[model samples]
Target: MNTISYRWMTSLVFVLFAGLLGAWSAADASELPALNITQVSENVFSAIGATAAPSRDNFGHNNNLSFVITEGGVVVVNGGDNVLLAAALHRAIEERTDKPVRYVINENGQGHAFLGNSYWSDLGVTIIAQREAIEEIKAHGEASLSQMRARMGPVVTDARVVVPDVAVDDHYVLELASEPIELRRFGAAHSPGDLSVWLPKQRILIAGDIAFHERLLGIFPDSDVDAWIDSFDVMASLNPVVVIPGHGHPTDIETLRYFTQGYLQFLRDEIEVILDDDGGLSDAYEIDQSAYESLDTFDELARKNAGRLFRQMEEKLFQ
Candidate 1:
């Protein structure tokens, strides 16, 4: 409802600056081995896969993540980056159970979500993404796929990308294999439409791109800052015991809050600093990531947190 503002634009520009810094700081020198999946619940799971680019300290190909294997057929959330990752996810789920993948829901319309959808859909899985996601794909799908093809090189040569078949507006609840899953709209946070998959019985929340455990967050200029914060509060209210983030390992409700509050608060503080110093938003874009020089990466998530916050504040012109 709130129209874009220069204040918000400043915020987004900062985020883009930070995303670039995070990428720079990343020391991915080698590709990591494939990710391995381990069961965390009776029928619930999460996995730490290959590093994102390899050679990066602690920054692996985490997008190579997912959950699945419901007797109601396999219901997955988030369709990673490439066919290899998708195939890896399929194989990982296969290790747990042979159930066919029935549905896949993309929380946001990132290249990661759209890239691997074709593999699952080829296997007959119904792809479900937000209506905005469908539009986003149409808008950027080919361009995104082009990037994916470049990244994956030969693997994506013939990628039969699967587009979403189910486009949701607000929210959706399904009775599947006796398990009820609630896909609720968190308004516009990371994107104009971001949906979180809440498994009531399991008390698990699969927050797509809205929440990051300890990774750099890429804030699309399209996101609403106030609404994003509010949505965070909404997600925190759910009190999920186990939260499955779009990236990063499984976490709890408090962790999600740390992302929304702690991270966002940090961005707000730094943005204020830049504003006070008359440091143009573009300046924030070129901030020396050394601002995190004193912070220890292992001791806390401050560096990545700062990077994400920087990204949110630096890129606000997204449609």
Candidate 2:
């Protein structure tokens, strides 16, 4: 397995392109939304999103988006939260290289996964996702879009749901212009159609929402907590050098295992302990979370994640 270093490398392309692009365009890359696009590898750049939720302030760019610049073209992971943000990503790409975006992979059926479809589609890019995710978008995508519109207000007006052209189930591989890319799904983990984009040569695994760094996982009603645990094992099995989380920072498999995977396991164990002790679901609030207390959104998400997992465990055990 190749070891991936998380250190930032100075991108001559980024600096050179930004300089040339600055003279040609009025909008500065820095003037765009709060996203900080940095070159994490030779051909890989990550637009690490904000820790906070989508709002008019941040323009709904709260999910990570990674673009791989290959000789053929570019492949983007996670469409982004809305059109405005996606357009910003488009410009960001323009600042880096002139390669057209060939494909956009929806990591899941979530709002951030496909909301930016229109922008990419307008440019003739084909979107791809797991078959289950396509079904999810068909079922609940409209309602999710409505909720996002209300939360984000005017920023999401242009956002539209565009389903992927290609539907992948277990695994799919693409030989892009420069490298071979692998798309693997870990059976209904974070979302029903959770997909991880892996670049074997780069040893980078874009762990969509399946792995989060120093943040609480959103346990949506349909989410399977047990399956999510198993999915973490699957992610670790890849031994990825760099794991670009669905949210938060790009990190290593160890951090993903301990912080993201370990935290989920800890939540399940604590909830189970409360249940085994004849304590009600409310008792999960008393579990010590001092270790993950400093993590982002810990206060807002910790209790909610605990309650959701407790209820799920209760149903599985009692039923």
Highest lDDT: give the candidate number. Answer: 2
- Candidate 2 residue spans exceeding 4 A from truth: 1-34
By how many angstroms RMSD does model 1 differ from the true structure? Answer: 13.2
lDDT agreement with native, every candidate: 0.64, 0.79
lDDT of 2 by residue, 146-263 (tens): 9877876643454567878999998999788669999998766777899989988878988899888767667777888788888888778878888899988888888778877788
Candidate 1 off by > 4 Å: 1-33, 50-61, 276-278, 282-319
Q: Per-residue lDDT of 165-260 in model 1, one digit per residue for the tens?
A: 998987788777788888888777877558788888878887877786556454445756667787888887878888877666777878667655
Clashing pairs in 2: 72-177
Best by TM-score: 2
TM-score of each: 0.75, 0.88
Instruction: Write down the lDDT that model 1 would get.
Output: 0.64
